[model samples]
Target: MRSLMLASLLTLSAAPALALAQPGKDCHLPGTEESLRCLRLAVPLDHHAPGAALSLHVTVAPALRESARRDPLFLLAGGPGEAGSDLVPLLNTTFRKVRATRDIVLIDQRGTGLSGKLDCKPGKNAETATEDELLAETRACIKGLNKRFNLYTTEQAARDIEVVRAALGYGRINVWGGSYGSRLAQAYSRLYPGSVRSLVLDGVAAPDQVVPAGAHDAQAALDALLKQCADDTVCAAAFPALRSEFDALAARLAKSPQSLTLPDPRTAETTKVEMTSMRFIGTVHNILYSQADSRRLPFLIHSAYQDRWQPFIARSNVSRDFSSEGGPAMPLHLAVVCAEDFPRLTPELLAEDTKGSFLGAPQIMRIGKMCETMSVPAVPYKEPAVIEAPVLLMSGALDPVTPPRRAEAARKYMKNAQHLIVKNGGHIVSPLGCMPRLLRTFLDQPGAPLKAECLNEIPAPTFQLNSAGPQP
Candidate 1:
């Protein structure tokens, strides 16, 4: 069944490439099987300074039709460190309808992808590393970088997008950004309104909302999941003590971190890991990103409370490692957070937000310590201005990081925009059920009424009652 669904999604016919205004070569993006055109544009390292320049990697997935639309869709990646080109598979599947009539353009942000990526060694395991050890690793990463971190801010990346647009000879392109990319898309629209015909922001990170504020939001998501399980007959009967079990497990781990040996999820080699309370909660938080993985939470917690650590450890390892693969480059991620989001966070605000939350103040404070070594000054927080372009905002009701409230806050500043909240969706709902078709409809006629009734048909996530999965 899964294979059939994938075959259906990949059914779009590819046509011969159209003649480009600028030079480019045929290449394959990392995540997709389709051939695409790749190009590199060199921009000044510092837009203000007259010195060295770095080449930005750009990939163009041409439309399936010979005569495509004049303006293409530019996809901005999340993480503030993720490469836009890395999102090809997602666009190829979810936005295939949009790709049928319009070209899709992806540019690797300055400090990520094949661009001048700030490569750094992965930090020691958070569960095992001491505070000093983590801080030392951060310092080493900073000392190893050759370029200035401050120059890679979102504002600068937005300017680079404009330059690429002109070079490619595109006029008033459509923009789609997810997560941090949603924030970047907004920045681009604000900076170059005339160049954008429409905007689609999924899982919005409002300009005024600091990155560390997610602690409270994550707590809310966990609470929602627990409440959902409680409401379900199968789940409630199977795990009647789910909430208390989770709380007791957290308290136990907090008092004494557990050390256990388990086979690696991928290699199946025995390995020892320290399961700290923060790590346990953090793993659960990460798993909540996908509704499928979330369904297994009740079972996972129940098993762990019964001292069956293998199921939790193996699943958590896979979840953590898989999410990090081709994800935000750590150095660039730090550069952006340290320069843009970290300074806005204060101890008072962190404490206030994290009070009574499972994800306490530790994670935010750790980031704060890393930011102390950064040379770049913080970019002052400013409310995003009203964008005149036609805008479509999407959010998942259960998003732990960027909740529906963030999209609600951003809608107030838009002159022409519509917000869609997916009742059963988690993070980044643009690619979910009925969303791809909705995207095509919106891009074709931004001001027209969206046929969004299909969103209401998306069923709520089912809980995993046992190893056999949800009762049929």
Candidate 2:
């Protein structure tokens, strides 16, 4: 009876579209006057069985010119849970150079955006939930999703994008993917090589690399930030013992976690939040994702060492904006990682991977515990994808998560791929410095040799020495 009700709800949830756009048609994008077309592509809940349905939301921003190329540029988002369509407006602006003569397409993958979401609620009590409670919640979520659980794999998602491409009447497509989206782009190219025209992967997370196996790289990013502080005369003079101060802060926090009353910037009300070793480490790790945020790390660490938790908490609150409106569906994140990445991780492999890294094993262990009960429907991809497309791989020299090394690893297998590193840049490199113009050039004529001299001029932002005033 419960199964029957779930099946009924699933069917009811996937209502018929008001007006489905036909293939090869150009119309106003839904909900806007923009020269774009929108449609819902019906995909099988399970690709192999083809019974119940799931709707994939696809949006296409047409070229400004009537004489545009038929091969559209497909943008894939990161998080393994972020909606690709959510980034359409941003891409439309950033890739305006390409938007002139090429259509930009955004598909909201399977488990995100307008598509049926599998969000497992993390309540106000989430921070204090025990491992057992967390696991139970995941198991319950899995039970609720039922067969829908099997449909959220990146492999299935890659296939779904192809279905949308064919339906939209595009013979081939260009793909630009960032972070986890880069992984999706590679998967699509590997699965359907014939459909690919060119590839742009920013913050490349290569196949065969396990998730959260990035702790070593993350540690390196933190080290690089400190090294940069030491290198700069103004920054070094401002915080002479920056490295020692950070080490002392970490050590002291490890021994005894601090409790503080900090002001919530939003409400201007005082709240008590614990500052633990794990939380501090995790916060710093998150800060390293961008060069902008990382500039403040030296100040934050120095302040924390001086027992001023207010600045740290204030900055951290800014970072942990866990609003519900647009978030990576946690269940989908777990499903994809558990299926594709975690299965490869063993006790030995994890220990070996995390050795000498400050992050240690807890991060990966937390993910492992959540996925104990989850089952993967298909075999994970074993080898690096051999993509023949005119691939342009971009990486940030200071990227904490998907470092430049991952791009190098990927380039080894790619036959016709050019790898570009943005020195002093963070996770995503395209938007930094003059890379957008370079990106536009790359997409315009992917086979042409890229002029990346502009990237050389983008020096790292000056480090934030003091919150009271700007650098001297």
**Compared with the true structure, what per-residue lDDT tens digits does model 2 show for residues 356-415?**
766768755767666765666545567665788899999999999898899888888788
| Steric clash pairs (candidate 1) | none
Using Cα atoms with residue i matched to residue i, what is each candidate's TM-score against the true structure?
Answer: 0.90, 0.87
Residue pairs with clashing backbones, model 2:
29-36
**lDDT top scorer:** 1
Residue 27 of candidate 2: its Cα lDDT?
45
Report every candidate's CA lDDT: 0.79, 0.76
lDDT of 1 by residue, 90-175 (tens): 86689799988898889899889888777654454633354356568657767777567788898888888876776676779999
| Candidate 2 off by > 4 Å | 1-36, 125-147, 319-325, 373-378, 468-472
